[model samples]
Target: MIANRAEPSMTETSSVWGTADVSSGKGASDENFPVGSLLISKALRPHVHAYYAYARVIDDIADCETLTPEEKLARLNAMEDVLLGKREAITRQDSMSAAVLRASLTRTGVPFETATDLIIAFRDDARGVEYKTWDDLLRYCKYSANPVGRFLIQLHRESLNAFPASDALCTSLQILNHLQDCQGDLIRLKRCYLPSDMLALAGASQEDILAGRTSPRLRRVFNTLLDGVDDLNRQASTLPSHIKDRRFRMECAAIVELAKRLTLRLRREDPLAGRVALKRTDAMHAALAALRGWS
Candidate 1:
């Protein structure tokens, strides 16, 4: 496991959700998503980029500990206020989150309420909260992750009937994220997404997690969790068909390709040390496959 090191400050707190001001030469190449520059219809690209930026910002605020609990809540609320147009403008001093929220709301045409729910989820993170059961985690997913998918779906003007499947896909993705970041969350961030009840059922505990080794008991527990992920993936496979529009179908396919790559990583039998992020080459291959099917 990696040492529990503090997250480095890469941007001003308010801009963590937007592009960082990297010098042209070196680290600028490492940006995730680069959705800003991807070759797509100009009208659609900005909305997609705005949603990604919003999600990125909330994730950074939740993962990074630069703010106190009170401060996190205030920043989140302020961002929601900005989304509602209650604030004149979000200053850099306010929180990068507010700026992202403003951009996200403006670009995607997402309702302020949806962004507010996401902010509430980040507020929950400030307290280091954990769920006690699958239902609890699903409720968390409702606020933490599902809104992003729902917002994107709305941007495409897809039917609401697809929301159930989208919810499943979004929650599955969230679980995959939890699995990938298990080691980092325990050792580096001192947090755990595994429910206490499930840990007890698996013969593991918070202490066992912090110990940084996967015992046979932990393996058994991890396998059970993986079973759940597999089921979710199966359900998610049917989601793309729910979106009849070719572009939205392709987007869902791209997402499925991402889930497929993560599922591949989980096939390994070892104690993880940090996140098992997907390689870009694999994603590109998946995108090509998706495009082929659409064509």
Candidate 2:
């Protein structure tokens, strides 16, 4: 049994279905990641919504501009405590996402320990601990991306170890996201997840990045990173084979297409200032292609 603290009662029972609701995945079309859209079957949307809502909540708390680092960490810790069937949280203010997490805990028995790892990863953002190497980024992914993959595996009653292919696909997507958001991560959050070796390999310095300059060295660095992303993209293509469900296959396809497109962008576009992204039309095409492939 998880420890119980004097936390607030789980009183809010509101179904998260609002326009701005992250769980409902209404704005998935605009997201960098395509998981929400790919998982849009009516029967499964609710579960996906629940997970996305909870993720969005933890993410918001960790990323929100209004909260201080200590406050964010406290909230995240409280969230962790609540997740493990523990009764203690810092506050029970009935946040949209917290409520969703609570309900997920009650309904799915998703381990609080795994969920807590995600919260801790988000909290790491507040501490401004940037990745110095690919292994360092992998540690971050262990907490952030790997847990989500593990939870998804549990959702399907699969073993985390049994589904190495799926895990690879999931982790690949997560790393791709980090690469895509490098500029935003640095400018907006003052965080850099880029590996130091990659930087050195490119002969690009943090000073060059901060100044928004696109030297030949920076271009080479992106090429190297892009090459790594290509390997992950290939791994993602085979993810459909790991799971039996066709729905997940469709999801994998959509994500694979998106990854492919990103890889294309890296090859063709100059995304150095960190503002690189895929357009909606292109994403829709990719998603469509992926869905068709599964069909």
Candidate 3:
């Protein structure tokens, strides 16, 4: 474990916590879906960015090839301490985003768990937790993905009823991402999010995830996950109707449409062939979905 020490001054770069500067430089546009898009009101956008920045910081730490799992956890704990105001982010290595999120949470009354729960997921990723069952994968999404939707709903002052749909939507989005990146994740991070049981049931194994194309057996596993995504999107179809904020409602509507399109494409196309992504014309489809939901 890293020894605890006082936060460093701006001029000082070294600290008890090792700082390797692991920023991935990925941003909202690089994301599979929208984050703080134009549909989010101007007043709330900065708060969204704060949350994203903090999430990125933790994600970068977890994904950094150079850091050991213990080192990653230590950095995560240090960031969380600053986020909770247990310590100041005065350290040259500490992320300003943690402080920004702490202040934003205080100002907006959004629960800090919306940010901290992500830490839980990052910890799991850093530790390389195994997936045995569908329930296990869902449990992962409970922390890794659901919080983002919950944060947005809370920030918009939406009804508690929206949570179930938001969870459905967010979890679906997360699984979609896992499917899209299954091959790359296994190759790069030596990680696999596909449930072990599902792979087994389909006569596939974790090793098969390394294939350049989706074999028939592996495609069976992909189909099973997509079946779940289909149902989750159905549940989330009601999400747009729950939002009172016009722009946000449109945003949710657009995302829901995009999720549906991506699901269809996954069903029709092979993710292992390459990165399966939304085409530019999908924007027109989302715009139409947003209009329909707006009314």
* Per-model TM against the reference: 0.79, 0.80, 0.91
lDDT-based ranking, best first?
A: 3, 1, 2
For candidate 1, write residues 112-210 as lDDT tens digits: 665677877777776778878877777788888788778767767778777877877788888776776677677665678877778898777877665
Better of 1 and 3 by TM-score: 3
Candidate 1: list runs displaced more than 4 Å: 1-40, 93-109, 269-271, 279-281
- Of the candidates numbered 1 and 2, which has the greater TM-score value? 2
lDDT of 3: 0.84
Which candidate ranks first by TM-score, i.e. highest? 3
Q: What's the number of clashes in each of the models?
A: 3, 0, 0
- CA lDDT, every model vs. true structure: 0.64, 0.63, 0.84
Candidate 2, residues 1-295, lDDT tens digits: the string is: 3344332222332243232211212245546675545464564555556666666667766666667788877777766655555543333332444545666655666665556678768878767787887778777877777777666666665545435655565666677667666676676767787788889877787666666546687777767767776776676676666655666666666766776777787677655555568878777877686667566
Candidate with the greatest lDDT versus the true structure: 3
Off by over 4 Å in 3: 1-20, 92-94
Could you give the C-alpha RMSD of every candidate to the true structure, in order shown?
Answer: 8.1, 4.4, 4.6
Q: Candidate 1 has what TM-score?
A: 0.79
TM-score ranking of the models: 3, 2, 1
